[model samples]
Target: MPRAWWRQLLSRFDPTPIPDPLWRRALVSCPLARRLDDERQHALRGLSAAFLARKRFHPLAGAVLDERIRLLIAMQACLPALEQGVRCLRGWRELLVYPGEFKVRRSHHDEHSGVVSEAEDVLIGEAWERGPLILSLADVQLDLEQPWDGYNVVVHEMAHKFDMLDGPPDGVPPLPDGINRRDWIVAFQRAYDHLSNDVARGRETLIDPYAAESADEFFAVVSEMHWSQPGLMQRAEPSVAALLTAYYGPSPAPT
Candidate 1:
């Protein structure tokens, strides 16, 4: 039978609503969702439903269509943008999920001679400008099954979406009124500098060394740690905690 024209048109704009039972079961099964209370779980479920309904989950070549995989991806993608607003994910719709870590070629200039060199990266997730958000199912599934500290690829990529909202993926986002942008600049700058110095000296640091690369990376790294290790960031760097809280509200404290 030929497809109905109205259905096709409607489906373009309307998202698929997930069933309550399926959603609830997903929360119980995933370790990452374990930290959330009932209320938070409910909110997350709603957000995921809306997200999955609106966005396109395009499995990479040889990928399977599994309920668990889609649920896991949806929940993670929505969590970071939950507080900010659903509009944060607007415009982008496609998601490419790979079976495992994929190779990406990144080209950069050599400082001295401005020679462009290409390097391969085993990436877990990568978001492109006006393109699909790609993820490694293997890596993310393991993370979901066994929760880790301050390293969430889902949140990390979503943070990029937020950072890219205003302009290019710069470290800064349009903060709310209460947060002083200047103060935020000073706080993040000092913190990034400190972390960069520690990484250079080969010393242990709470946040990842990748943060030192750029302001955008710093925001993404700190956003992951801010949610994963909220208490630590709060106690150790009050300014960072305050800034995050202003942007995303109080998140679940790390156990």
Candidate 2:
């Protein structure tokens, strides 16, 4: 089927609506919800419901569970997916939530000797391209009450999903038919180079320096900037902002 036809079909589907109690609980627990008004809150609830209905949630570590906790996780995870539209996250299935920070092991190999070395680190959430999403419930709870404007673990992980959409997480996704893929490459490259130079020169970067580490990180950091500091993102890299807007639509005016 053509992209236009898929979109048209999806348009006919109504966004799932969350129950009133759940929406109220989400507003109480998640500080991010404070930014939204009544109507927007309902809209968010609807989007979140659609996401929960589409994706599976797997709770690990803690056997104890409640509706509010799960809804909290769903709301945050769904925000980015909702912003991009329901079909954006269609490929993924389950969300495996751990009780706290979980250890992820990484192995290094000496290319010449072909010997392997291993290391581990704790993480909040990770998205696998063709696999399930891993999340830390404890970290998610911390995020619920915290007031950090742009530091959303859910959005960060979902950004990786966007990066992975085209193939590997290489800082870009498939553009609409008329948009030039070459132009996207140029724009992202220019922004990436600029960020790298700023880090090298010890200049203040609007986003974290970790963004300079890789194209994937660049995409994720830029995504955070899009929602957290849109004005700054627009000024520093208009093309990035344009790309985000093209995908997510214009953000609602600050209320």
Q: Please tell me which predicted candidate would have the highest lDDT against the true structure.
A: 1
lDDT by residue (125-216, candidate 2, tens digit) is 88899788888777677766553555667767888887787788898776666567888889899999999999999999877788899988
| lDDT (10s digit) by residue, model 1, range 36-151 | 77656655666676788777888886778588678878888877765655667775788898988899998999999989999999888988766788888887777676555667
Query: Model 1: which residue pairs collide?
Result: 15-53, 16-53
Instruction: List the global CA lDDT of all models.
Output: 0.76, 0.72
Backbone clashes per model, in order?
Answer: 2, 0
* Model 1: ten consecutive residues of lowest lDDT: 1-10
- The top-ranked prediction according to TM-score is 1
Candidate 2 Cα misplacement greater than 4 A, ranges? 1-16, 31-43, 63-65, 177-179, 252-255
Model 2 is weakest, by summed lDDT over 10 consecutive residues, at 1-10
TM-score of candidate 1 relative to the true fold: 0.86
